[model samples]
Structures are given as structure tokens and as C-alpha cells.
Target: MTATLDHQPIHSWLTDMDGVLVHEEAALPGAAEFIAALQQYGRPFLVLTNNSIFTPRDLRARLSRSGIDIPEESIWTSALATARFLAEQKPGAAAYVIGEAGLTSAMHEEGFILADSDVEFVVLGETRTYSFEAITRAIRLITGGAKFIATNPDVSGPSAEGPLPATGAVAAMITAATGIRPYYVGKPNPLMMRTALNRIGAHSETSIMIGDRMDTDVKSGLEAGMRSVLVLTGSTQEHELTKYPYRPTAVLDGIADVVPLVEQLTPHESVELDED
Candidate 1:
């Protein structure tokens, strides 16, 4: 457990899952207690994530497996926002996707038609099978006047071996081959942030976004007009904050520190310090 800091009253919160809640199948230290504090206070929050590999239900199930029980509706994923964008931009239009089952299912559910030929849009997300044929097809479609869309611009994701290339790598390949840029729909993009706020029915002034990445999560919150808190449990390091163009409203070691800060700000809650 970590010590908390003094903070202002926060009515709602938006958090990133991979680093703040759990690293893999195991829950992070003090994650359970942090969640319990939120539940006890009845604070409305949403677990917003940039990983489009899984659906909300799938993510909720994974969290449950780790003893973090969160409702499905409270889980907002990049896939859902990306699909919604596609539906609004080109209704009933054909799209060629290079993502996993989650992205494909989301688009289909949004009433977008999947076309094997003559695709108007080429959507890119994370996929295990990055075959040569698929890349060739995406290149051909883009050359034939198709618009490109990317779920996120993140180049890599954390793995046991370290960071591994993600959708951004594939998008880069397509861009190099087709000479076109993709419109991002994930974190750091206002679209995903707006979708999260809408789902939680939270006002920008009263909401706070907490995450480990500065470029994606913190930047997204700042751009969306919400308070941003950067946690040093994953991608970001304490020393790197000075190099970034933007800064978070607050900084902490992890989610555990957030509880005391929130409790300090709220009138009826009390906090006591204990060394682990």
C-alpha cells in the first residue's frame, strides 16, 4: 500500500485498466482496496481503456477473474468508440478491418457492412495475424481511394518480454505503402474521451482521469477538458514527466495513493496512515 495525498473532492473518475487495476491476470497491489473505497463512497467511475482487443463483457469477465468486480456498463473500450465513429461517419458503408474479433464484432453491431472488395474505409486495430496478404490488401484498398482509420496511435503494448508492437505499427506500414494518414479514434483522441464522459454522465469539470501513460491517457483527459492524474505504475516514469510538453494535474505512485487523496477532499471520510 502507498500513502495518500490531500486532494479536492472528486465526484467521478476515469481510470486505465492494464496498469492501474491489473498488470496481467494478477491484480496490482492495493487495487482491490482502491476499488472498495470508491464503491463505499458511491462515486461513479468508468474503466476506460485503449486496448481494443476485447469487448466490454470480455474485459469485465477478466476483471472478475482477478477479483475486481465491475459492471459491464462501466467498462468503456476503444473498440466501441471506433465502431460508433464509423457508423456516424459512413452509415451502411463497406469497411475492411485489420483488427481482432472485438473490432470486427463492434463494427458489425454498429450496422457497418464488411466488404471484401471495394472498401470505402480501412480500419486498423491490434491483431495477432499480420499476414503479408492482409497488408497487401490494405495497401491496395488505400491506393484505390479508401480512407484509413486507426483505433489508437500507440506503437506498443506491455508484455512479459517487454513492449511489443501494436496496431500503430501496422498503420505505419499501410501509410508508408499508400501515402495516406489514418484518423485516430482511440485515447488522446477527443472522440474516445467524449464517449466515456457521455457513458458516465459526468461533467468535464467534476471528472478526473487517472492513467500511467502521459501521451495517451493523460493527454486525452487534458484535451477532453478533464483533470488528469498520471500514475507511475506502468509506462511512465517519474523523471520523464519533465520532458513532456504537457503535465498532469496530479501525480501518484499508483491507485492506492489516490484513495487517501480523495478521502481527504471529501468531508465525511477520514484517512489514517499505516506503514506496510
Candidate 2:
């Protein structure tokens, strides 16, 4: 593992949402404090998530309810990255979308037109309800020469009961039908990381990505030229570290361990407390 000292002069920070900050609708230990430290030090940061079922505002409310107090603009979803990519690749292009408000709202914000036919792309995103009709429409659109795109390549997502099918799983089904694979815009693709960094006007060389998963989060950060930190509070466990070929810049027990490092990695002034 790379030493934390090598990550000096970190100008910005990025972290995963679910396991790193909150789990089961509650903020993890030191999660809020880590965020507060960053804010106190004027660090540019973003809370990243692959879930595209909700918009930034919606996520902000959810996090606030969980006692995270994250601002709307500080949240970056895979939906937003996909929208930005499409907008840049084919500005104002029409598309057949299979997603909820999060994905649709992003397209709307990027001036994309949503349609069933005569479209340039077939976009797939995360949603609680995956209608067969929508899937059929997406397959048909792809077969008709429309490009296929997905917000993230996650096969399943965590839930109270168990894992639920995600965008990648549906994308696989669509590919089986149309023989055209959708381009995934989220982790472990570095595109999502780069897009998020660009959104905050931060450079990857000076940014550190903190995540719990080695496959998506850590890999994406490393590929994006940013230092990566893996916390043990999520899916990946300490014993599982040796299973991966690559390693993170640092590993810690949880987000709590990162709070003090926030000031150590960034340039900040010290304030003296008067004796009582």
C-alpha cells in the first residue's frame, strides 16, 4: 500500500456514500466529522454514488435525514456523469431512457430530448421498478442502430432484504437481445471519477478518493490518477485486501481515522485556545 505521506498537497477529496459515510439510513462514526473537517478546511469535495435512482437534491435530503448534512451540489451521481458525457458527445441528442427521475432530470438539465423512437441513444439507469415494457423498448431501440448507454455497471445493489438488480444486470439483458453492449459511465470506469473531479474544478493529481470497495471505488480512483483510500466499514473487509492485485494509497479502519488526516494532508492554520 502507498503511504499517506505520498498524497501530500491534496487539494480536494471524494468519497463513496453508502458504506463510507452512511449505512442502514444512519451516519457512520466520524463520517459527519470528516465532512465537517473538510468544510472547515475549505477543501473541495464530492460525495459520489453509483445509485442513479435519485437526483442530487433528493440525495441531499436523504443524507440530511441520515444526519450527514451534505449540500446538494456536493453530491455526484452516476446519472449526472452519464448526462454530461452524452451532452458532450452528442449535444442535445434524443434518447430512449429507462430510468427514474434522477436519470431523466439529468438529461433534461443537459438539454437532451427523451423519445422512444428516432433517437440517438438508449440510456439505462437504476430504478426500483424495472418494467419489462421499458426493457423491451430499450432493446428495440438498440437493435435499430441506437447507441446503448448505462449509468453504472453494478450488477446488483444492496437492500434491506438482499441484493437487487442494478443497471449493469439490465444492460446485460439488453445486450443479449440486441448484441450491442452499453457503455457504462460510472465506476470502475475512470470516466465517472474524472467527470466528478472536473465538476469541482479539481485535478486528479491533487485529489484523493476514499471508498470502501476495491473493485469500483479504489480502481476508479487509481485509474483516474488520484490517490485512493479504502475504509473497512463497507463491503470490502481487511482480510480481503490480499485478494486484489492493486492496492489503495492507504487503508484505515473507518472514516473516523480520516478526520485527523484531513488537516494533515491539507494546508491549514492553527488556532490557539485560551486557558479557562
Candidate 3:
């Protein structure tokens, strides 16, 4: 399809990885081509994901294994955002984390001490092994007045085998146990969106947030004052858009459409149109 007059070129693009860029171990249809086109145009963009199980470097390696080679700096995960938030809120504070190496490593890098005693925060993410004792400890920390923090609230995510419980499920368990709400740092949260924009060095008006989820990605962008696009490659189905409370500025089948739209404009025009 040709670019429309009303079609504004996006300056900086933030895209979800699992469904929009890749599905499981394979790059989604048109994903590589779309990214190649963007790189050729010398546009700035970042791969933003809610998955906190892996660090950006780890994610880059995995993506490379899937034939989607990207630099580590170009990737951001909820784990990184959560770590930054914690660092700002309580730098060097003791934390009781219920997550994998990514979450723990991120907190450590942020100068937060991981401990169970006198913990200032109880952070939760996707954990491969969630023992009863771990849950009990997390509850203990929260009950003792530690602040609760969640990476993302997604209950489940898509995998090569099938859908699996996401970090939000664990977060929910902690919430149910302690009757405490968590400060979430993933998509749908304004903090993550702001961090992504800051990393890209782009103003909200000149950036576009693209994802498949209305509640997280689209809502987060709208709340952050950025233009949003919804793609129908992941969790969101076409028929469900009408019922979603949050709406995006544009909708397409995938990032493939974005390439053509962006290709039609010069770099200057792209920035101008996005700023509008």
C-alpha cells in the first residue's frame, strides 16, 4: 500500500520483540526486511520488551541465534527499567528479589544490595524455579514493610512451545499474599516509556510506540504523550480493537507496513511529520 497524505513518518520507533519482531525462535514474517529498511534509512529505533528474564545483552544473543542480529545497546527490557527505577527510588537499598539472573544482576548493577534482612524493596519478575520458600520469603519481606515492585504485569507470554506464565502472575501472587500493590516498570507504565524515549534521545511528539498490546504498550505511549501504533501480530486480534479502551493512532498487520510508510519520506520530512 502507498503512503497516505495523512500518514506521518515516525522519527524514533519503539517496538515490542516477541510478536512484532520475532515469534519464539524465529524472526516474524517481514521482520528482518523491515529492520533492514529502517537501518538503511538511518532512523533511530529500539527494541523494547517486557520480558525480564534476560538482560539486553542476553536478549541480543538470543535474537542473533534467531537470525535477528541487533546491538545490545539497541535493546531495552523491563528488567533494565525496573533496575533504573529502583536505583532512583532507593539507591543501594536491600532488595528481596523473586526473579532470575537478569533481574538480580540488574539490581546489583544499580548498586542495590540483594538481601532478605531489612529489605527495602521486594522485586518480582519471571522465575523459572519458584519454590514455596521463595514465595514465603517474598511475603515476609513485603509484610515487614518493604515496597513491592514488579517488572511487568503481563500474566502470560508467547513461547515456541506455547503460552507460559509471565512475571505478572508472580507479582499477583505477592499482591494477593501481602495486599500490597507494586510499582510496575514495564509497558503500560509511563516510567518505562519515558526511559525508552530518553535513551533514544527523542521527544515524545517525535516518537512512535508500536506493540500488540493495548493495555501496556499503547496505553503507555498515550500516557507518555507519544504517538502509538498497534500491530496485529501478537496478543491483540483485529476484532478486539473496537472493545479496547485505549486506542492507537494507527493499526497495521505488522512492522512491514511501517517500512513503506517511512521509506516514502526524507529524513527531514520524517522528523517533521512525527513532530506533528
Which candidate leads in TM-score? Answer: 2
lDDT of 3 by residue, 147-225 (tens): 8889999888766677788878877887898899888889889889899888879777777888878888889999998
Clash count list over all predictions:
0, 0, 0
Off by over 4 Å in 3: 1-9, 270-276
Q: After superposition, how far is residue 133 of candidate 1 from its true place, in Å?
A: 1.1
Please report, as a residue range, the 10-residue window in candidate 3 with the lowest summed lDDT: 267-276
lDDT of 1 by residue, 184-251 (tens): 99998977988888877877777789898898999999999887778888888888988899988777
Error of 1 at 112 (Å): 1.1
Scored by lDDT, model 1 comes in at: 0.82
| Best prediction by lDDT | 2
* Model 1 weakest lDDT span, ten residues long: 267-276
Against the hidden reference, what TM-scores do the models get? 0.90, 0.95, 0.91
Better of 1 and 3 by TM-score: 3
